[model samples]
Target: MLLQHAGIRPHPDYRRLMRALRLHAASPRGELAPEVYPADVANFFRRRRIPVAIVREGNTNALRKILAQVRRAPVMALVRGPEWGNEDHWIVLIGEERGMLVYLDPWYRPTQRYRRRMTNPVFALRWRGSAFSLSRGQAQSVRRA
Candidate 1:
């Protein structure tokens, strides 16, 4: 993972982490965006012509609506890393199939610089119903070759 390779610790703040992830997405080559935040990600989606509907945080009613849309399409979760002090993390939740939570880990820019080459690739894993369970696994087998 770029995060791991970059040594950029995950932010504890879910909101901040999401923002960082969105910023990471702007650079396909793993460059960080000058300004990254939830709003940025939301705007990026909108500019790309992706439909976005903001829901109240932790709102069950809103969650249901979002989940319904996610089932029909891809849903990305901008969340905080377990160790992030207050920053949020960004994770894409494609769907629940075969008891797994498929997602993508976009590139991240860490404060520490490393000489090794790292490739940020999207993968899937079995959703264990917890943040920790969202492990990196092989890409969806269904993806085109």
Candidate 2:
């Protein structure tokens, strides 16, 4: 969806990745259960040769650096959603508009401002342009710049 919004064609290999993830399951109530780890999403992009910098959650200083980076490019992050009682959710940091970050959410039709529901992102994964650059560090640790 982010790729589509960015006017880029998604790689077909992503389909295989999603299938392997088993994103859907049958519940006792006959409902579809879908869940994906943030690592899975990061790995999916890694497999495609994208550079990724994983920043730790709650690090305001590091986060500010990342936010600044996104002002020049796009990024993907795992955050808590307003509707799901702050459940884990994925959103893309497309860019800034009128001094606000623009996000492409899978559950909504329109783009929303970063202040809406991204109140404390658990982590962030930044890539270089459409391609990602790999960073060295613990996946959950945000190194001081």
Model 2 weakest 10-residue run by lDDT? 136-145
Residue-level lDDT tens digits of model 2 in 1-145: 3333333333345456455444654556777646666656666655554445665455556667667656655666656534545666666666666555666667665554333323223233322222222332213222221
Q: Model 1's lDDT to the true fold?
A: 0.40
Evaluate residue 17 in candidate 2 and report its C-alpha lDDT on the 0 to 100 scale. Answer: 49
Please, what is the TM-score per model?
0.40, 0.56
What 10-residue stretch in candidate 1 is worst by lDDT? 124-133
Local distance difference test, candidate 2: 0.50
Q: All candidates' lDDT scores?
A: 0.40, 0.50
lDDT of 1 by residue, 1-145 (tens): 3223222233125554455346435576566654355566555434433334554455565445545655554555554533333355555555555544444555434444221121112121122111211112212111111
- Candidate 2 total steric clashes: 5
